[model samples]
Target chain A: MKVIEPHIHMIARTTHDYERMARMHTVACCEPAFWAGYDRTSARAFHDYFTHISQFEPKRAAQYHIQHYCWICINPKEANDLSLSREVISFIPEFLAAPTALGIGEIGLNLNTKNEMTIFEEQVELAVKYDQLIWIHTPHLKDKLKGTKMMLDYLKGHGKIKPERICFDHCEEHTIKMIRDAGFWAAMTIYPVTKNSPARVVDAIEIYGIDHMLVDASGDWGPSDPGTLHDAIFEMRKRGHKEPVIETVFYNNPCYFLGQCEKFRLTPDRPREEAWA
Target chain B: MNSFNKQAALTPPKNASELLDIYFLDIRSALLESAAALDRIERAAGGKDILDDPRIQDLKRACNIIMDGKNNRSEQILLLLSHPLE
Candidate 1:
């Protein structure tokens, strides 16, 4: 089946990885702007990073025949610096106009700190002002539940925020039900270590059922692999999940969500279901 | 197949069987490493009653969770090993 890797860092991946994704039938992948494994020193550094992902990375992925899309934002990890964060946010509109750009995202809290929340709210305002889609990064491990709840409350209370147009990534068992119940998309990221394994992801599918659910291999700088997405497909197969159910999780679900943006061109095979049946 | 209708799409480079064949050695190596680590821990303990150690107990619990017939062993073990929400 044609798979859409809903969240990955293509800028952190190599052409060989792109080749593997193409061979595995990954037609499109979205890269939300994230930390570069180090603290970037200035807004100019973020300019270069966004430029590379929006312009240079798409050409690179085209060599392997995969569509590379991205979201532009001041990621949560570096949002602690107020001056630097505002400066970065000022130029986000220009990048958002890029054909590869999806929306302002991966832009939630890293530490659930006051500064991170402020910047996240500002970015949310920016997204709503422009009528753009949102992709969020909930904090890892111990901080995840609180951080997720924090964002959910803010978005739910916001007058203009539409839950269907937004997604929260790095979701685990404890936080997914709240996200889905609130009408937002919940994405389970498969990592080599320290995140949901392939078996766990499939088990979540079996429990949750796939409506607005998405699965991605967060192929980033840490100990992660792009093949984990395919491993999830295999996990579902081993458990006797039919091909349509597997297709719905890896392919159609992402299309239904990402295709909300005009820049994303992949189409879902089935009609969009507003609520999980 | 319910709502899906893509019957002529491109297949993955490696099907499920091919993937299992390719990764069998990797899985075996991981199991071996876990076994070796447990053996080293037991040897270092020198037959002391380490069963009461919380870490050992958790590991034992994790093993049982994995052996159970139910799916979601990973989630069960993760929640088991995780510190309670503070």
Candidate 2:
């Protein structure tokens, strides 16, 4: 069961996590540029963070026989600082040219604030201009429904950013329908303490049917555990979902969505026998 | 504890309704514990650091969701458990 972790903060994780993920059959993983647990003081900070994820992290993951990819952005949490964000966004294209750079993401609202939305829209335009994939982080808890609605309305109204090229992540039972109905890809993140659990994610898949759906760990500086993803896989198998169904949701779905970027080399139908060879 | 391994070996629920009920209970319990932990951390940190801490921000978000009465998963769960394929 080869997997592609569509969203994770690999820079915050140790190399041992990579070893575990590889053992669990994770062929690849993506690190989206996000808030580094603190507000960085300057664009130079983001420059270094991007470089670490893009350059250093891949080398680290490769040592475990896992290919690492990443998304670049100011991240919604830091996008509130307009001046700092502008400085950071100005140089994002330089990192985008890197081989492992996939698209602009984990870039949506934090507090659902006006500035966050402003930066989010600008980044969407940036993605559009550069013809890049967009991965979004919707607000959590009470704000999730409203924030996701706001993003959907904003993206739909813009009318130019293709829905298929964008994925709204951290979707829950409340928000998945609207996201899928609106024709955009939807992803659910599994967490150890705070967010969706494995069984709940399986419930979402069972109900919604995995068309454009994806599941990831969203593992980061918090108490998240990457193992929750495999737990979901195990949960699905326990629920009698066939191997093909599990493969589609965990492997094929991410490949289908992320493969829109030419840099993502794996495909849903690729011969598994040749994976290690 | 090896409780996860034990739980993994448990039999699958007979139907979507049963599955939904189990998942809702599990998720509810996890969220409640997370909320309680966050409350303790907030009290110890004295409210000031919550504004700057991203982990605290996530904790606050999760806590807010758990506290919201209107954010119940029962309706969605019911719909899924009932239709199972809509």
Candidate 3:
């Protein structure tokens, strides 16, 4: 099945990983700027990182026949350093002009600290000002529920933001309902080790009808495998889900969400008989 | 950088060994990045609490394995590179 990986850190991945993903039928992937497994010291570092992902990574992915897209932001993990965060935020708009750039993303609370909240709001404002799509990264494990609620409350109170234009990623069982109920998009990120597994992701799909929901592998520096996404697809198929349903979750859902930015090229496939004509 | 251009297609690897080479190269690079991140974190934190963290230990162990370059697959790659079949 054709897939669009809605959240992955391609900067941390290799070209062979792109090849493997292409072999798995990943037609497109989105890389959201995230913590480099550690904090970056300067805005220049972020600038170079952004350039690599926005310019270089797409070319790399293209070599493997995969269309690469990315999001830019001072990720929440580093947002605590307000000075550096502001410095990095200042130049993000310049990168936003890059063609492959999707929006300001993976931008939300890490420790749920006040500084993280401040930068998150500022980046949200930046997204609003530019009329860009948003991709949020909720905190992990224990902080997730509270952080997701905090983000929801902030977005609700913001008054200008549209629910459909934003996606709260890394959602779990405890957090998915609230995110979906509020009319915003929700994404579940499966991993090789910790966090949600393929079966759990399919379970979420069964529990919550696929409306504005998406699933991704969140391949990164940690113990994540991009193949886990296909494993989830296989699990869904094994559980008797129809091809169309699988296609919708894997392909069409991403198209529907990322299509909001006009730069996304792929269209959802029509039924077979219509295509043959 | 402002303009997006299509990249030229790359030929896929012909054999399983070539594919394994590509995969190992990526794994090594990723491990190096992880090692560098750990180093930065340790340095920033003055090597106090950072080294003690279990997560940091796990990353360090992964990095050591890849960097040693003496394992079965990596060693084979090294041998092939150092003594090419002419």
- Top DockQ prediction, candidate number: 1
lDDT of 2 at B45: 47
State the C-alpha lDDT per candidate: 0.85, 0.81, 0.81
lDDT of 3 by residue, A7-85 (tens): 8898888778998999999999999998987788789999999999999999999998899999999999999999999
Error of 3 at B5 (Å): 39
* Pairs of colliding residues, candidate 1: none
Error of 3 at A216 (Å): 0.4
What would the per-residue lDDT of candidate 2 be over residues A1-277, giving only the tens digit for each residue?
A: 8988888998888888999999999999999999988899888999999999999999999998888999999999888888889899999999999999999988999778889999999999999999999999998765676778888999999968788889999987777878877788889999764468787788777677767789999998799878888999998877777777688778987887889899998888643222111
Residue A16 lDDT, candidate 2, scale 0-100: 87
Tens-place lDDT per residue, model 1, A1-277, is: 9999988998887789999999999999899999999999889999999999999989998888889999999999999999999999999999999999999889999889999999999999999999999999998876777888889999989988888899999989878878888888899999866678997787677677777789998898788988999999988776566787688888888888899998998888876553233
Measured over all alpha carbons after superposition, the RMSD of each candidate to the real structure, in angstroms, is 5.9, 9.5, 15.1
TM-score order of candidates, best first?
1, 2, 3
Candidate 1 wrongly placed segments (more than 4 Å): A274-277, B1-86
- Poorest 10 consecutive residues by lDDT, candidate 2 chain A: A268-277
Better of 2 and 3 by lDDT: 3
Query: For candidate 3, what's the TM-score of chain A, rounded to 2 decimals?
Result: 0.96
Tens digit of lDDT per residue, candidate 1, span B1-86?
12422222223434678768866897789779988987787777464666567888888888898788275666677667654654
TM-score of 2: 0.79
